[model samples]
Target: MEEVIVTVLSEVRCHLGEGPAYDVASDTAWWFDILERRLFEARLGKGEAQVHPLPVMASALAYVDDARQLIVAEDGLHVRRVADGHLALHVPIEADNAASRSNDARVHPSGTLWTSTMGRKAQTGAGAIYALHGGVLSRLFGNITIPNAICFSPDGGTGYFSDTHENVLHSVPLDPATGLPVGAPSALYRHHGEGGLDGAVTDAEGLIWCARWGAGCVDAYTPAGERVRTVRVPAKQTSCPVFVGADFGRMLVTSAYEDMDEAARAADPQHGRTFLLDLSARGRPEPRIKLGAI
Candidate 1:
């Protein structure tokens, strides 16, 4: 276990910060405060983050270009113009269903967008994973309680996600041509540690960097389920981790303070802040989403 020191990047007291991703075009980092209905973007070592309030509660996002973004919000996926922060509804994904909202999401190397929906109140078995391609949305799996870690392998041959409530991570074979699941998913990793698996991202070398929700660290594991390294953070409820910096040599971690009580918050005042860690491991840039309407 290598002890890595992380610096506080943002002190924005977020309730449930998640969906941290790097934008290669702008050379910046972006994430969402799901409960606060806000999105934040910042340049490394620059100034304060520029905050934009989303019309609906947004969970995850991916860059469409340097000037636009694809956001998965309470009303489904929308195209947001970055210049004026204008959001236009592009696709209605469960907009009529008030019980659920979008959660973890990412873009595939094959130009497809994948996302998950969970019950707003954390209701059991009220969520599922979905894929959006060719202007169509399809559900991949169902009966999920809390979906997280929706990421893909470096080779784009596999997809990984987890049901946090179950503390089990699963993987599925993906079709290279269509970017859809080719077969059934199998259990890849089970968290018997102090924390459950939350959001995750795959490194350039095909290692999965998972944020352990209550463990206060990010664990790097091989594709074959071998834990190799651990990087600890100051916060207890780590939400997600994104590899960034020049050539993706650094990591930015997001955490939460949503469910903590008074005593817990006092014990760790940096619970909701973002952390930046200098890393020797390099990472590949995230693929830009290819939405049909865009």
Candidate 2:
């Protein structure tokens, strides 16, 4: 396979871009900028991205049990549902640790919410991985530091989760419904370059595609951590990735311009841009869980 090119679909100029998810049924894409405390959406055919600000910072999102609402990660997990022309919170995740907040989350085929959290200042190995089954949370693993990219196989047998701060990726056995691990996590691979990882996607052949933040690239890897190909991103801090569009042919990326200097900003003009990369085939996107509105 060859590395593909990602094009800027829209610029939101979010301070810290992350969390890209597609609403396949609606032909729309959704993402968030944590620092800006906002969620963004765009129709499948639209070239522009629109932002909807929230009172709390949303670090990540996953489909709740309901089809019309989403669970977001920030100070805590919250249920955001559409009602009366607004996305309102229905349930809240009471994070016990103030210094810890979520970075990425994915809904398993069995409908469990899996997310990872890191230190407030980006400190390494200071976070934990969690599984939210039926609205109850459990720490699946510890010493994660910074869990970034994540994706599971079509059959939901194998799973991959990464911590960019450690520059390592680990494969674990996935329990479809509970999102629990049957055994120990096996080490897959680690990045040898400058940037870390952000979000990830699973392709048609069960290949793992990961966004390399700060390195301006996304890579496809085998389950054992063999690099298959790399897609070069135009800007810095390529934070999130999701396969959207009909049949999941379009690769949607979210970038960040957070904590950048004038010189750094000048080097990359596409920061905070929502990009789209066309692929040979679209991957199936994870289904969204709708948490009923309160």
Give the top-scoring candidate (lDDT). Answer: 1
Give me the candidate number with maximum TM-score. Answer: 1
At residue 251, candidate 2 shows an lDDT of 89
Q: Which parts of model 2 are misplaced by more than 4 Å? A: 1-5, 65-67, 83-94, 290-294
Worst 10 residues of 2 by lDDT: 83-92
For candidate 1, lDDT tens digit of each residue in 119-235?
A: 999899999999998778999999999999888997789999999999888999998666799999999988896998999999999999989998898888888888888888889
Candidate 1 to truth, TM: 0.97
Evaluated at residue 211, the lDDT of candidate 1 is 90
User: All candidates' TM-scores?
Assistant: 0.97, 0.91
Global lDDT of each model? Answer: 0.88, 0.75
Candidate 2's residue-wise lDDT over 203-255, tens digit each? 87888889888988778888778988888788778888888887788788888
RMSD of every candidate to native, in Å, equals 1.2, 2.4
